[model samples]
Target chain A: MIDIFTKFSGQLFVGLGWTILSSVIALFFSLIIGTVFAIMEVVPSKIARFIGRAYVEILRNIPLLVITMFFYLVIPKYVMKINGFTAGTIGLTLYTSAFIAETIRSGIQSVSGGQMEGARSTGMTYWQAMRYIILPQAFKIVIPPLGNQFVNLVKNSSVLAFVAGFDLMYQANSIASTTFDQINSYLVVGVLYLIITLPLSYYMQYLEKKLA
Target chain B: MSMIEFHDVQKYYGHFHALHDINLEIDEGETVVLIGPSGSGKSTLVRTVNGLETIQKGQLIVNGHDLSDPKTNLNILRSDVGMVFQHFNLYKNKDVLENIMLAPRIVSHIPEEENKKRAMELLEMVGLEKWAHNMPSQISGGQKQRVAIARTLAMRPKLILYDEPTSALDPEMIDDVLQVIKKVTNESGMTSLIVTHEMGFAKEVANRVIFMDQGQIVEDENSASFFEQPKTVRAQQFLSKIISH
Candidate 1:
């Protein structure tokens, strides 16, 4: 293990950087997309709700790797040219957004209906009430679940390995192939993932407590 | 001119009729109490004023807006109509002060400095000034209702609706919430339509009382006369039932 770390430290760090970058990008885009779809699912218009429901249902049911592969292999061949990293990140974002939308929609529903009534009775518009009163409460209610989704999202970024996006898992594969020390290589990768996930788990718990 | 007018208003929840042939008028500055057994449409009628519930058939005009018109803008009317609910419904994400100041700031665009000043004054009026920073969950039920009242009053609405505001509180907490409402209405001279089972409080604050049964107004009379001699048989039975308990 020590020898593998000493020889592959630079490659491992590069992989770690790429993993972090992809996760951050996916997290940011996914949250916005998820929230929009969540709102659409609940809005008064049936058409909007249908669109939101369809998006969430279709994307969430598809396997994440298949979606990633389509973007990687198909989009480049059909209409546009893009790198493996871009394709993987977009796939991750859309897939994770579907789950986030579901989480947030449930959170929104959990808030008392009276909150919207109270806000609207004060003369706030529907969107206004939703923005100020409903969404804030919904987000608070969903923090724990959302934190779970975020952790899942980060781990799932490992899907990038199959597409040559060069994430941590990709580095482990390369190191194992070169060094013939598969156990130690993958072990190092697993520990690094723990380093990311454990702190995130703790931070979410802290946030839930502080908000409560 | 009357502040609210409902001419032959009818509401239906699919096959079940909720409000039927409702012809009513509420003048400005008049405090009216609406009393009825559960499912009697008192709540449904009050909600229609704020467009929380829409009337199906009839002309309903509130604060000069013809609510029956498809183009009527309800948001404009809502700004001048405040509502206090049985559940209090204070914004759980906001502190007491923010709950009071939010509508005034966002809906009406009151200047921050002035909005804060008026919010504090309203808080003081409700006797919850010290609870300015407390979250809704941290407060007692009565205190939360007071904050909710302050929140409604912050909009400076010309009319206020109380939908069984004290019904959800403990027996001991009811008086505190009622007292704040009494003081607020008297000081502001705002038109109020209250739906409550608190007969004593209704008799004290209401100039007139309306009795409802099975989605119809059975009697509308002066509070003093109605309490002393309820005209309709339904009103008599209803009053006796509630007063006995």
Candidate 2:
């Protein structure tokens, strides 16, 4: 067991690299997509709001693994030949964006109606008021909840394993199967997950306090 | 030309008429006070001039822009018509100075230095120059309302609307806010429309008083005439009740 652990330590580090890569990709795209959807949800146009609501409902209700599988297994078979890593990252982004949209929508709503009225009464166009006054205040209110979504996004990247995405959990599974050291292999993987999640959790808490 | 004109203006909040066949005019530099019991639509009437509340029927014109026309550019109308809400409604995230400067900087596209000078001047006028950097949350209710007034004045609007500006303040604080308002309206020659429960402030500061009840204007008279001998029974009852308290 000890020898197996020593031998697989390098692979664990490599898996850590894939996990970090997946998380970074998902975080980058999700924030952009989420912000777009959030804007759409708040915009006065009926069609825009409907589209935004439909996207959030559809993405949020489906299981993350199902979304990953749809992209990995279903899409490549017919529409495109995307690989597991791309598939998993796309799935993660879509899933996380739905939650972020809801979080940001509530944040925007939490800002007092008087603020918008005050801004509009001062001759600001709707978009101008939203950009300058409403969004700045909404972003502040959404920070703590947004941090939680980000941390969850990082952990949810493990769904990459089911699609042969070569992430941490995938490497852990391969090591455990080959080495026949199930408990120890998973224990090591669990520690690796903790190593990623613990600091992320701490950082989010730190940000919440700093922003507050 | 009249600064504001509401010609047969009507508003309904889903079958409940909020403003009923309102026809009135406010000339430039005239200080008109609207006095009424709660739910009498005084606030709603003033809010329509700024297009905060849309009038569902007839022409509502401010500074030559017809609010009843969908094609009318409300933003331009609002730029010339400023409002100070009863609750102050100061942006809580901003400091007193930022609250005053934000509209000028963002909406008017005024240069930062120039806007700061104007904001400082308004703050000094309101006697809150010392609280420039203090957040709205840090200020008293009266101070916040005064800052709200200063914020309105920063735009140099042709007309200003005060919607029960002293109604939300404590008894001790109401006088201070009223005094600032009195000084501003007295000194600026700006067209002012105030909806207030403070009869004394209205008598002292307003040139004319309009009494409203059940979404209708009961009487429109000069301040001395309105207070000394209210013609309508509703106006008399409202004044008696308010004065008794």
Candidate 3:
């Protein structure tokens, strides 16, 4: 037991690097997808809103493992060959985007109807009002919820392990299987996850204070 | 032709029948005051001219655009006919100067310095020149409404719609806003449609007074005649109730 703990401690730092990589990739793409979907959801046309709604509903309801597996196992067979890290990062982006869309949509709705009317009355088109007035106010409203989605995306990247993604969880799984030290290996990974998530959590808190 | 006309206009909110067959006209540079009970559709009538609220059936021609026609480009009409809301609806996120300058810069596409100059001029007109940098949240209701008026003026609209402009204001603050409004209408000759409960302001500033009840115009006359000899029973009843309080 002591030997396993001693070995795992040094390897845990290696796992931390993978976790950080996964989180950065996932956060960047999720923000892009989330912003696109958020804009689509608020668009005037019925078809645009329907398409946005369909994407959010379908992605949000499915489990992260199922989505990761679809990208890892299904896509590679039918379409192009892709690595596990690419598959997992794509899955994390899609899943986190759905939640982020919901958060941003609610934020947009919370802005007063009068603001839209005021902007429109001044001859601004719908898109212009949304871009200049509505979205800025909505961003202030959704900051806390958006922060939660980012933190959850980091944790949810563990779904990568199911498909041989070289993220922290995958490294922890391999170390446990080879050494027959499941408890120590997972404990190390848990600490590594905390290292990534704790700072992210604090950073979000700092942002909320600064913005408020 | 009249600069503005409402012919047999009607509006319904889920069968509530908010405005009945309303017919009216205002000539160029005419300032009309609409006064009535709370649910009398006074606000709705003025809002329709700006195309803020659509009329269910009837012809509303304002500044040459037919509002009843679905093909009318309302954004263009809105630029010609600006509205001041009851709540002052100043952009809470923007300061008074930005609130005044935004429409001219974006909608009118005026250059920044020119727009800023016009915004400052309007702010001075409304006596809010010193508070240009203050956010709407930091200002008093009267100051906010004055800023809202300046914002409307910045658009250089042919007509201004005032929907209960002073009703939401404090009693002392009401005179300040009313004074600014009077100064604008007197100086600019910009046609205006004001919906207000301030009978004194109505009598003082209005060229004509319209009394509405249950969505129909009961009396339309000069402000002096409307107050002195109200021809309709409904107008008399409304005046008695308003003046008694």
Candidate 4:
């Protein structure tokens, strides 16, 4: 393990950087996508609700690797040419967004129905009630579950390895292949993931406590 | 002019009729209390005035807006009509001041400074000026209901509806909330429709009391006369049972 760190430190760091970058990009885009779809699911319009439900159901049921492969192999052949990293990030975002949408929709539903009625009886338009009263409360209810999704998303970025996206798992594969130190290589990457996830878990716990 | 008019209004939940031929009119500044046994449709009738509950038939007009018409903007009507719920549904996320200020600022576009000033005045009226920064969860049940009333008053609505506002509070907390309600309603002379089992508060604050039974009005009379000599057999029985309890 010591030899692997010293000899291939530069490559390891590069992989770490790519992994963090992809995770950040995926997290930002997925949260926005998820929230929008979650609202769509609950809005009064049946058609919008149908679209939101369909999107979550379809994306959630599919394997993450299959989604990445479609972006990598299928999209370039037909519509536009994109790199392995782009494909992996897009797939990660879409996959994670479905779970986030479900989490947030449940949060929105768990809020007392009387909150909406109270806001509405004060003469707020439906959307205004949703924006000011419902969403703020819903987000608080969803934080812990949302944190779990974020951590899972970071772990699932390992799907990038299959598509040569050069994330940490991709680097671990390459280092292990070259050095024949598979156990040590994978172990180092595992530690790097722990570094990203443990703080996130503790931060979520802190937030829940603060909000409570 | 009448503040609210329900002409042969009908409402149904599937096959179960919630309100039946609710032909009633409330004059401006009139305070009416509605009392009934559980499932008697007093709440359903009050809810229709602001279009929180839709009617299936007949003309329901409030503040000159015909709620039976689809084109009528319920939001505009609601801006002039405020409702207090059985649960004292203050915005749990907001402090007392914010809860009071939010509708006036958002719905009516009241200036922020003016909104704050008016909200503080309302908090003072409810005897909760010291609790302006407290969240709803931090307050006692009576305090929460008072804050809820202050929130409704901050909108300066022409009409107010109280739907069992104190039923959820403890016995000891009930009188404080009732006192705050009586002060606001009496001082403002706002038209009000209240649904409650507190016959004493009804006698004290209501000019007229309406009794509902199984989705229809059974009795409508002056509070003094009704309390002394309830006309209907149902009303007499209900009075005796409630008074005994």
User: In TM-score terms, which candidate is top?
Assistant: 4
- Per-residue CA lDDT of candidate 1, range A78-168, in tens? 9899888899999999999999999999999999999999899999999999999999999999999999999999999999998999999
lDDT of 2 by residue, A1-212 (tens): 46656899888888889999999899888988998899899898999999999999999999999999999999999898999999999999999999999998998889998898887877888887888778888888998888889889988999999998888889889999998888888888888888888888888788778867
**The CA-based lDDT of model 1 is what?**
0.94
Residue A169 alpha-carbon offset, candidate 4, angstroms: 1.0
lDDT of 3: 0.88
Off by over 4 Å in 1: none
Q: Write the residue-wise lDDT of candidate 4 on A160-206 in tens digits.
A: 99899988999999999998999999988898889888998899999
Query: At residue A73, what lDDT does model 4 achieve?
Result: 99
Worst 10 residues of 4 chain A by lDDT: A1-10
TM-score of model 2, chain A?
0.94
**DockQ of structure 1:** 0.86
* Docking verdict class for candidate 4: high
What DockQ do you compute for every candidate structure? 0.86, 0.71, 0.73, 0.87
Compared with the true structure, all predictions reach lDDT values of 0.94, 0.90, 0.88, 0.94
- In the range B65-128, model 4's lDDT, one tens digit per residue, is 9999999999999989999999988898999999999999989999999999999988888899
Which regions of candidate 2 deviate over 4 angstroms?
A1-5, A77-79
At residue B56, what lDDT does model 1 achieve? 95
Kindly report, for each predicted structure in the order presented, the TM-score of its chain A compared with the true chain A: 0.98, 0.94, 0.93, 0.98
Off by over 4 Å in 3: A1-14
User: What's model 2's lDDT at B220?
Assistant: 93
Better of 1 and 4 by DockQ: 4
